[model samples]
Target: MRKARGCFIFFMIIIVIAAVIIFYFIGSNDRKIASDDSVKINYSEELASYKDNGIDYLFLGIDERENENKFEGRTDTMIIMHIGNNGKNALISIPRDTRVELEGHGINKINAAYVYGGVNMVVDEIYELTDIKIDKVMLANFSAFIKLVDALGGVTITVAEPLHDDKSGSDFDPGTHNFTGEQALAFSRCRATAKGDFDRMDRQKYLLAELFRQKANFSIIPQIPDILKILNEDTKSNFKTFDYIKVAFKMMINRDDFILLTLPGESATIDNVSYVIVDPDEAKIFLNENLG
Candidate 1:
């Protein structure tokens, strides 16, 4: 019996070691891509260069379940996370359905930029639409986002009201809810309320703040390997390694410093297509007021 027990213990140790090796390779933590302009190549490159102070970073969460390897997909969520040198941070959430005029494609939903020309076109359209100089971009798809959240054990959020959206698979009551990775993803996607996208924008900001708060915990160190791997495979960032680390640290420390705002626009249906007509000048004013 003693001999058998010893063999079983040795086998379990070997299995654990093997699993660690597999996850390490799968995560590709050391391998990271650095893009100067866009996530992909473009003939006409018009993009903002990386800056030091008051950097504006675009966080684009895309619906990339279709293409796993290419990092190309229609953006499901667009957030402008601005960090100023004065230790202040602001976040502006742009609805995916917001209408914009891409250079090649006249007028379409903002999310369509990725479908038309990948990240290059999408970044260009944002610059045109908001007139905001984006210093960096962080791109991730739904699957990778969920995986990172799950690897962190999950996040706790307070739901102000009961929400149930069959479209997004979100169902939760008013309370402090401990959401699994999948639940968190669904909550971020829910837009079936009377306010529709408006309510979703609020949820996204709330979730972002909550995630940052959760990340400040030192307990998350053990999960870093897995999370980094997921980020390497599922996300793309134009920021340098130091910049990424800097912003991450800032986010953790200044979660409450986030000034969450959404672009002001009225909804209109043109040619039976719903759209949000955003005036570039107005958006610029709003940013200056909130960010300046």
Candidate 2:
């Protein structure tokens, strides 16, 4: 009996070691694509202070559930992340269904930029629409997204309604809910409620903030190897290694400094299609007032 117990203990130790090795390899791989077209880039040209202490990056969640390789999908979620010099951060979520003026496509749903021209095009359209310069971009499709949330040991969220979706195999009750990767995806995709995309945006921001909050635990640091592997495989970012470390430290140090804001716009329809139209004059004022 003593010999058998020793063998079992050794087997468990081996299994644990193997899991660690696997995650390390998974987290270490990363490939970056360089862009040659300068005209398409807009965020880099700014003042020294803005370039140094203050930086802005756009996080784009694309619904490439259909065909990610082909780059065919709508921009399911668009968020602008801004970090101030004092380590203060602000995240503004843009609703997908908001109607706006497309750069070359005239007027259409803002999310349609992905279907028309992929990430670069979508980024350009946003620059034209908002006049806010974006310094970096992070893009993720659905699968990578699920992996990211799950890697974080799932995020805690408030599920307002009993959500049931057959396709994604998601069903959750209303309350403070703990969500796995699949559940988070469903929560982000939900548009059936009374507020529709508006409500969904709030949930996305809330869940993301919660995840950031949870990441403050020192325990997550060791998991970096595994997380980086998943991120390399499933996520795309223009962030350098220092940028990642800086952001992580900032989140840890000043999690409460995160401010939330939505775009200043109203719903309007032109012809037959509905749009979230930003009154240009009013928008400039709002941007200067809030950001400046």
- Please list the residue runs of candidate 1 whose C-alpha ends up more than 4 Å from where it truly belongs after superposition: 1-53, 66-70
Query: lDDT by residue for model 2 over 1-292, one digit each (tens)?
Result: 9999999898777667656754554344222434323113433333212433367778888677666472346778899877876645777787676676666787678788767765666666666555666677777778887887887788888787876666545577888888888888888777666766677787778777788887766767546555777766666666655566677787787776788767777776778877777665666566556666
Candidate 1: lDDT of 49?
Answer: 47
By summed lDDT, the worst window of 10 consecutive residues in model 1 runs over 27-36
Top model number, lDDT: 1
> What is the lDDT, from 0 to 100, of the residue 10 in candidate 2?
86
lDDT of 1 by residue, 179-235 (tens): 988999999999978788989998999998888887766566567667666766677
Give the whole-model CA lDDT for all candidates, comma-separated.
Answer: 0.77, 0.69
lDDT of 2: 0.69
**RMSD to native for every prediction?**
6.0, 5.6
TM-score of 2: 0.78
**Inter-residue clash pairs, candidate 1:** none
After superposition, which runs of candidate 2 have C-alpha atoms over 4 Å from their true positions?
Answer: 1-31, 35-53, 68-72, 164-170
